[model samples]
Target: MPNMLLGAFPIGTKSGANNSTSNNKNGKCKFLLLCGGYILFLILGAAMFSAIEAPKIDAISKRVQSFRKQFLQSNACLNDEDLEEFLKAVITANDRGISPLRNATNEMNWSFGQAFFFSSTVITTIGYGRVTPLSQTGKIFCIIYAAIGIPLTLVLLSAMVERLLVPARWLLGTFNSKLGHLYQPFNIRLLHLSAIVFIVITLFFAIPTAVFAYIEPTWGALDAFYYCFISLTTIGLGDYIPGDGVSVDNRSMYKIFISGYLICGLIAMMFMLTIFYDIPQLNLGQLFTESTNGETEKLHLSSNNTTCYSGPSGLYMPQRDEDTRRAIVRIRPHGDDSPSPDEAPSSLNSGIRVP
Candidate 1:
């Protein structure tokens, strides 16, 4: 009977020891599976995007080649030495003076307003490349300025977004109050996200596109919309830029205003992204976490020393002092030499005892 009692006491301990090793192995397996899944998804997505874009890319390449061949064959000036010399003279003229494409008025590219605009673009990572620093001194200044400015801009944007979250959460709370009884929490959260997305798109994309179209003579609605999308997304393709083709009445002021618009639009986009990520259903990262029930069980077991077992009522109960007494009585033998209840072995004491 003593041997049986001793054997039963170690059962929980042995299970716990086995569980620790199994938990570690399970965690490692989960990590590897997640990594492999991510790699596979990335490869599949790349292949899918390439397949979708390849036909248009090939068509554009063929058209560009044909245009180049036709232009070279049709133009007799290409075969003339005098024309070639003229081209060389034009290149040399660019070295002496500002490129005609940059500022036809011969105004300095390093003017304070233009420099400020350039700095904003660089720090924001827009890099339009329309007007670049031409001198060695200017290039060196740009490098130093960007290194400091990028972090400062990031901090400013993050602070602004953090404050913005106050109203965002309030908006979510309002939605919950209105819809909580009728809908699941996930659905209500999705609706809240949609509201933010709509506001961001209207304020940043739609309104800016309209304003840009009205201001820039060359840009139509579609062109302005595309420019706004590309700029805010930080793609910065540099193909279609405002205030570049034809000189306006106040070009420097226009550039500065565009820079301001870019900064605000980026902030709005960041806010939208933050709200989107806050919705756990949309976040793929939640997949890597353990289930809620399993996590709860692990946390409970780790914090308490008492063993859990089924009681007479078929409910699981932690083995506290009262349960320890019952276990001792069951394990006691019928011999007269057996110890009384009060003289039971100290090893049979509760694992967790209140003081």
Candidate 2:
């Protein structure tokens, strides 16, 4: 009995150890899943908010605009007689109660405002339903128009980005090659990222901001910068709009010019994002994925950063060393009981050494 008990002790101890380790792993996995679920929830909530909030704000803004126009017209005649008449007319109208809602026809004078709005929608890809093409021909044409124009705009932006990426990649390489010994790979990548950000601010933001301020009436430097910032981000509040300076005789030409400006500006901003992606460190979260491998991993982030795992080889490198990090991954036996480095056995005893 004593001998039997002695032999069983290690087995029982190992079994308990295994259970503990398994529980730890399961706990980790559960925590990760919960975190992922929370992130997904936030993303969905944000998208829903954006879809609903924008149109509601736009409706409120239109109402405010109408009220402002009425106020200005009333204030135009401040003298006693005209003021009294205007006040009486406003009082009578208020008593009768103006329609709280406007039909599409009533907002015709605000069409130019909606053009600025359409420009914003185009950039953001939001295309809300409140204002739309009234004529059948216009409606049919709009569908075909967006299909072609959106892709063409994307292509133009992508091509420009490709061109810009070459120089950006080269610059990063030069910095890495020269200062590699002085810093960790991540540090070098950070320096390179800073350079790109500096260029983006100087070329796309500051200069354009200055030019816009000079050209547009009612725009100071801050307002111009705000317009450029909002338009580039595709927020497009549609307030502080431009190109209203042209006389009524040249309205069509003015509209065309404004349309061209918005499109070109939007494309240029997209190209800036492309240039930003050329920096590997900034893109680490996005680029980490399952399909990536040893050779491809060496391309940018892999080349500079130290991988933390060695798989079966027991060599610890950078996090990017493993391919498909973002991919849904499952660990299992490779058939011969030979454990892949990624699935090496945990140190705890009694746990099934599946790897």
Q: In every candidate, how many clashes are there? A: 0, 13
- Give all TM-scores, in the order shown: 0.63, 0.48
lDDT of 2 by residue, 63-172 (tens): 97787678767877555576558667865543332222332123332256545556445544544333456569977877777777677767776776778678878987
Query: Once superposed on the true structure, which residue ranges of model 2 sit more than 4 Å away at CA?
Result: 1-132, 245-264, 278-281, 284-355
List the lowest-lDDT window of 10 residues for candidate 2: 1-10
The whole-model C-alpha lDDT of candidate 2 against the native structure comes to 0.57
Name the best candidate (by TM-score): 1
Backbone clashes counted, model 2: 13
Stretch of 10 with least lDDT, candidate 1: 3-12
lDDT of 1 by residue, 146-201 (tens): 99989998998899999999999999999999999999999998999999999999
